[model samples]
Target: MSSPNELPPAIFLDPWLTAEGDGLKALSQTIAERVERQISSNLSQSARRDAISRRGLVVENLVANLAIMHLSPHLENRDLLAVATAKTKATRYDREDYPKRLLSGVVLAMEELGLLIRHPYAFRERSTTVAPTPDFAATIDRQRVKLSDIGRALGAETIWLNARTGEISFADRTPLKCRIEYQDTEETILLRDQMERINAYLNQSGFRFDGEHQGPVCLRRMFLLRSLSDPHSFNLSGRLFGGWWQELRSDRRHRITIGGERITDLDFQGAFCQLMYVHLTGKPFPGDPYAIEGLEDHRGGAKLAMLTLLSRRGDLKRLSPELKAALPRGWTAKRLMDAFTRHHPALRDAIGKDYGVELMATESRIMVELLLTLKARGIGAMPLHDGVQCAASSGGLVAEAMQEVTERVLSVALPVVEKPVVGQEWGYKEAA
Candidate 1:
């Protein structure tokens, strides 16, 4: 609910950032020693020694995470690394690797050493946050950490379930992005194996976001599986998440490159609509799916209506103001729905239903097929919902590959729209 301008960026403390090379490992060791010495001098000797000794790895691991955050090209000094600690309810189902008890001590010790400024929970919803003090930055400065040797994020479990109702619910039940773990079955194993392979390729893909930072700004992209709506609802919405590029708007994402070359992005035109239509009717819709009477000039309205029609559950009821603005003036919600259904008669019986999850599952599988197909040829890409971002030189190949893979996945070749990085318009159609 809070706007981006309202709060400072909180880079979550990632426990997965381990010291990669021996040089960084030694640096973590050196930082851990300084923390231990400082804590030992201030606190009771036996208690500090025993407690710190018991969780040596935890202390260094915390140090490593903080170091990685600071060294990251994606971040500036003002963006603080927010950590969760000593809050039993907050971290109940969190992670076994980064125990709250051990981390709480490290946080306190670091604060005691004047290396961190701890912000107690501002509200019930937030974790206790911390920003490194000048002394801590000076410590990193003394170590001479470079961007090239900085990001070596070891891979971790990538398959996750998000039962947030929308990955939108921050309610206590699902809590913060509503991400929950799922029991992996044989089918899930297949999906996991597929995602793991994609992650592996991505780790080595050499893709960079090319942000304002002078150095390479790679965000350790490995596509993770996100099945939404329910953890128990296994086949519901299996979408690919975790690529940082997916977060960028098209204009900003124009800066992304694979191996320092300029980029090209290909989006499947009317992908999900095509998916649902072909899937339900066993044949593609004949005409332009967005074409309809009365709104011929406003294709944007027709498309948004089609989207809302598929995703909006329950009664048609009312249109949101944003939706209304897109549509013809003074048209009632029912009238717009009627017009849309009449135009695409095939989806008439399917209106007011929850096909959004089903469409995501269908689209994710289509993307997986395309991703794996490209990976096979050593062409790397970042998978969007119904499209992919790849090297500009590979644009033509990626477009063709997408056509072949979508045909195999959905039994119909969905149209693809090719977008060059420097282009003004949305995209040019590779095929219709």
Candidate 2:
């Protein structure tokens, strides 16, 4: 086996293909032999062999990508199909119905190796139907051990595994040059250094949370320690919209802690509405932005309905299933929109305006300043959509920084919504 000290093939650029290509070839050949043996006699031996080899080649290319998903468990089938099609140059993958066929094949191969188990992933933000295996890291560690033996026999370093996170980085230089549409060139270059710095900070300061939390929940929580995209600023709005933080289930958000201090979440009240009101009228709303005239009892439903209608530009016919499901039983999208419009006339008029984009940019500016200010003071903080979380002891400091940033960016004073202190009474403290 290549020693840990031996540098991996520098050709990780293609990731699916490596400088020492013999190892992948050997692995594919072994899988093909197994698949060929299992084929029914309905196909002739030569035909069966050819089919198995084709399927095996696809499987060999996908192994590394699947292994890397240990860190980002929410990858959808469509995204995987895009990657597979690009990597294998398989024309069949471009078909409209290709995702189901290709993903099922990949799932079957991984299951045969006891590498993955499918779970129902029903997040409102995700359109995909399946979740990555919760045990992806453990499974990949076993594969890495097995592949180490295979590498010893082959006498080459074809696999590049990060033992710490079970993240598999590609060592093939060729395939990586293919362009992806959403690739942010600047963030892509800085990602590695960002991870290293975050890792060092977390390891040195120690991250602590409640022990009663389930393992998978805790795994998601750990995403705060590493970011997938640029953290220097927000994605579109003042909010940091991308990465593991945005995907974390709301109930589990309060579990994060640092240096024995409980973390508290603080956000602006009626975030978008207040911002929009300020933008149009040059003043914040006097009361609840979500308060409907006679339908005050349905504030929560009213708020959601208004946001949905505004976001879709009052296209009630094409309202998403999730939005439709959020309303009361008898309420249709059109009915909800009519009710919200009657009560919020000014907001209704403001709909289809360019204010939302402006709101996001303003909020993003506030967040950038907050983050930079905290970083300058050597304080650790995390961003939620309209709020910031930090060690409970630093709550006052974080709040002051946030207010200062908001006023500086918007030329207005914004209201704050402080979430109750978390992990304080539970006898949990940051690790010493």
Best by lDDT: 1
Candidate 1 error regions (>4 Å): 1-11, 21-30, 41-82, 86-97, 112-117, 122-124, 132-148, 151-155, 164-181, 211-233, 286-306, 316-345, 423-432
Q: Give the Cα-based TM-score of candidate 1 against the true structure.
A: 0.75
Mind sharing the TM-score for model 2?
Answer: 0.53
Q: Kindly give the stretch of ten consecutive residues in candidate 2 with the minimal lDDT sum.
A: 214-223
Q: Alpha carbon lDDT of residue 85, candidate 1?
A: 67
Each model's C-alpha lDDT?
0.68, 0.47
Residue range 268-291, candidate 1, lDDT tens digits: 877767877887988777767887
**After superposition, candidate 2 runs with Cα above 4 Å error:** 1-83, 87-239, 293-300, 314-319, 420-432
What is the alpha-carbon lDDT of model 2 when measured against the actual structure?
Answer: 0.47
Best by TM-score: 1
Candidate 1 overall Cα lDDT vs. reference? 0.68
